[model samples]
Target: MKINDVILRTVTKIVVFIILTLSVYLFFSGHYSPGGGFIGGLVLASAIVLMYLTSDIETVHKGMPFDFKLVAALGVLIATGTGFASVIFGKDFMTQAAMKLNLPIFGETELASVVLFEAGVAMTVIGVVVTIILSISEDE
Candidate 1:
């Protein structure tokens, strides 16, 4: 199926950017608010899928610049590494530490190791979803 509608292509470009931005926002806010890695990753994947639908497979692949399977593996490795990092410090597995630090622009902000864990989760989710979409698209 070829998508030749210029309006759709233009709107897709704008919407894709918005969706990607929102996904990142959700990921960051998740540490303190309601959003989280899972939801954020799903949103990001949806944006990619939208692009895939609007463009050719080759174009989508070129834009991605990374293999989905490799991404999934990296995500797992990162999450595992984060979990084991605590062990190296004589702490239990997956132990999360939080600290409040004052920055130049951002006043006092709380930082936690769990953010890394969430990032891993988000990457894993995005990789899995994209892989699934690629597989299905290829099968058709």
Candidate 2:
């Protein structure tokens, strides 16, 4: 690749790494704190958008490891499904509730399932947004 390519790639990689890493932290923190999934996912998508700016979609495809559409779809499905999950049990939509945890790292963690649902929404929002933006910008 050209020297410009190398530099841009490096910058994009750094940015993506930082944003994604931060996103994970923020996303997890949101479970117990104020931040939510929408912001975290948007931040994550920002990282991907940074990479998209520096490289072609073809290269991004190779590095991303999975289909963004699929991942995003899963997030949305999970979030929307959360609504159905409530009604299935005869609960109201977007109702807040506690859930059990079994993780050894954070044993007996108290998590609000609604928060998890919101986080999934965040992921899907960012994913769909980035997809649209990248596709549109590709023409230029």
Best by lDDT: 1
Per-residue lDDT tens digits for candidate 2, residues 1-140, read 64557877777767777788898877778766766788788888888788777877888889776667777898888898887788877888866688788889977877677776976788697879787887778774
lDDT (Cα) of model 1: 0.90
Clashing pairs in 1: none
What is the C-alpha local distance difference test score of each model? 0.90, 0.78
Instruction: Please give, for residues 52-134, the per-residue lDDT of candidate 1 as tens digits.
Output: 88887889878678898888889888889999999999999999999999999999999988989888888999999999988
TM-scores of the candidates in the order shown: 0.93, 0.77
lDDT, residue 124, candidate 1: 95
